[model samples]
Target: MRLNESTIVSASPKLIWDYIADPGNALHYMSGVTRWEVVSERRSGLGARYRMLIQVGSAEVGGLIEVVEFSPERDMAWSSVTGVDQRGRWRLRGVGGSRTRVEFRFAYGVAGAGITGYISELVAAPSLRRHLRRSLQLLKRQVEHERLRRDAAARQATPEATTA
Candidate 1:
């Protein structure tokens, strides 16, 4: 199964990239995810590994995932090797003049284990889709909120520095 979502953020690509590419920010943006912690020497670039947990219907599942691709302010991709069979990618596109469009894609194979995985994916697809959509919405909100805070701080500073 695969899922995709795109959201516009009122900030520069560089600023958004800094947060999205950080390993510590996964749970901050992912709605289904409950925990994410870096497990490799590399932090957020290629080959970095992280242990993550996703709340799937009352059960949490996930494990060590390695970053396969990382391009500063552009793209980030990861694949799981030791746990669930899944791959995910995040693409950042500049919308020109201080705006960014972030596109997220997730692809995962359902294990044919006793028909449960199949059944679960069937029943859970809608919920998972909703989670993904809300996750992107939350990400947009967080980024835009940060942008507003920065702008407010700048506006306040402008007045003080100009007077001095």
Candidate 2:
């Protein structure tokens, strides 16, 4: 099955990229994700590997996933190495004025399981879609909050603020 979701976040693409590129922040913003640990030497770029798991229905499903595509603040894609067959991508497009249209695409299926796999994919779609939507919302909130904090700090350090 394949799923795509998008959201417009009130933050720069660089900020969103910085937050999502860090594996350590997955559990903080990603809904249904319980584990996202760095399992390789590199942490935040192409070839980086992570042990990840997401709660789906009654079970946690995921495994070692490696970053197959990394385009800095633009896009990142990953493919499963072991566990559920899946490919996921994050696409960031600047929509002007410090805003970004963030897109998340995920495709997964159980190979060789025939009709059972098809049924399972259909069954899991709603929950996975919900998780994706909620995850984007959380990410937007977190990144926007960080943006606000940085803006406030910059304002505080300005010459005008200091003189006033």
Candidate 3:
């Protein structure tokens, strides 16, 4: 099954990309993700690997995944190297001043489980979609908050603030 979701974040693509690229930040913004651990020495670029898991029904599903594509502040994609078959991508585009269009795409299925796999994928679609939507909302909240914090910090550091 394939799922795609997008949201507009009131922050630059760079800010959102920085947050999503860091594996350490995943759990904070990614709903249903119970575990996201860097399994390779490299952390945020192409060829980096992570052991990840997400809650599905009563089970945690996922495995070792490797970063297959990384394009700085634009796109990052990963494919499962072990466990269930899955691929995911994060795409970012600057929409306007300090705003970004962020998209999350995911596809997964059991390769050999036949009819059972098809039915399971169908059954899991709704839950997965919900997770994706919620994750984007959380991400929007986080990056926008960070942007505000950074802007506030910048304002405070100016000479005007000290004089006032």
- In model 1, what are the clashing residue pairs, if there are any? none
For candidate 2, lDDT tens digit of each residue in 74-133?
999999999999999999999999899999999999899999999999999999999999
Q: In lDDT terms, how accurate is model 1?
A: 0.83
Whole-model lDDT, candidate 2?
A: 0.95
Cα lDDT of model 3 by residue, 28-130, tens digit: 9999999999989898799999999999998999999999999998999999999999999999999898899999999999899999999999999999999
lDDT of 3 at 36: 98
Q: Can you give the TM-score per candidate against the true fold?
A: 0.88, 0.96, 0.96
Superior candidate under lDDT, 1 versus 3: 3
- Clash totals in order: 0, 0, 0
Error of 2 at 149 (Å): 0.4
Stronger candidate by TM-score (1 vs 3): 3
Off by over 4 Å in 3: 159-164
Per-residue error (Å), model 2, residue 143: 0.5
**What C-alpha lDDT values do all the predictions have?**
0.83, 0.95, 0.95
